[model samples]
Target: MNTDNTLLNAVIGAVATIGLSFLGVSPVIGGAIAAYLEGGESGNGIRIGALSGLIASLPVAVILAAALVFLPLTGDIGVAIGGFVLVFVVVAIGVGFTVALSALGGLIGAYLKENA
Candidate 1:
């Protein structure tokens, strides 16, 4: 519930994401862990999950977006741009889905902690 705990959990969640990525893992699991550790209300859990996901994915998103720059080297610039836009859309949706799933997990964790 405290701001300090929230920040700590968010940092842990971000680090967990990076570690899990090496094993081709999902961010939702890490988000849940962070939220569970946070141990607040369901709303707080959801907020922590969303925050965690955002933090966790930020660097990867930036790198992937930057990689779009190389698309122009192989073919038509117009097509490349269009393809990049489409891929960007997909990535955005994927990010949203990841955040949503993390929120769900966080809610579950919150409930479990409350019931326990």
Candidate 2:
């Protein structure tokens, strides 16, 4: 992996993460959207979304890490690809974290509602 590619990926990831956060569309929302798109039931959407998001994000992280650690290239081509992959991974991880947090929030909300 080229040092330039690695640095570029990191920069792109940071920018993308910030952008998504500002859009009020975290990974959890993306995950929930994905589940809904797949025809998941409303009752189970949150859980399914969380699981799917987590699973999906792992590959993204791996790919980004691999690009930084394994792929050997230089110049604009490498930078472009690395930037794209890095952004993708950041989005995926954001979605996963959001979904997980949403799930936990739901559970806590439900427990409180029930107990109250």
Candidate 3:
């Protein structure tokens, strides 16, 4: 694999994620576009999409962690998991969601490009 091209694709994916995010569009679309432009095999798109999704979710992970820090206690000891654990779980899920969606998008785009 060409590391330089892969890195380039990842960078493009990141930029797409950031820009599409501000446009109220799903960042996965950006990942798909980047992977499509990268023009490698399907697996390449998947890898690039995953990278993009992970990077795109960085800000969300930070925001979720910050928000979880100020939890109001409900006096329910049973439901009181450590804030760190909760935050981690939420952020992990968010990352997982992004990765899955971005991967799907990448797969579709690559397929279309290849078949076209």
Candidate 4:
């Protein structure tokens, strides 16, 4: 209910996202719930949502990074470079996708909160 606490709201949203993910719900719904609870302007909602998305993505990023790091690399320098590049591209795209979806959800949630 405290709209000023952006970090708290984002954490709550990330929790919601993790929970909803188990139930097959979209992360967008989690972001919307977070921004709705935040109860502020759209910009604030966007911030909260993006932060939440980033927080939620942290675990996935860590796991992916670990996997890439622990992978046994052949002696070929080109293959090692290509592998790292591929991992980087995948992680970047995934984070971007999640953030974009959450931001859109935040916008929608702000509108709904304002209207209601």
C-alpha RMSD (angstroms) for model 2: 14.4
Kindly report which residue stretches of model 4 are placed more than 4 angstroms away from their true locations once superposed: 22-25
Best-to-worst order by TM-score is 4, 1, 3, 2
Runs in model 1 deviating more than 4 A are: 1-3, 22-25, 72-75
lDDT of 3: 0.72
lDDT of 4 by residue, 2-110 (tens): 5677788888888888777765445687678778888789997787788888887888788778767644466677787788888889899988877777877777777
For each candidate, the alpha-carbon lDDT, in order, equals 0.75, 0.46, 0.72, 0.78
Maximum-lDDT candidate: 4
Q: Write the per-residue lDDT of candidate 3 for residues 1-116, one digit (tens) a residue.
A: 22447667766776777777766446568678767876678997787778777777888888897765565464555445566578779899988987777786677656766876
Order of all candidates by lDDT, from best down to worst?
4, 1, 3, 2
Full-model lDDT, candidate 2: 0.46
TM-score of model 3 relative to the true fold? 0.73
Clashes of 3: 0
Off by over 4 Å in 2: 1-75
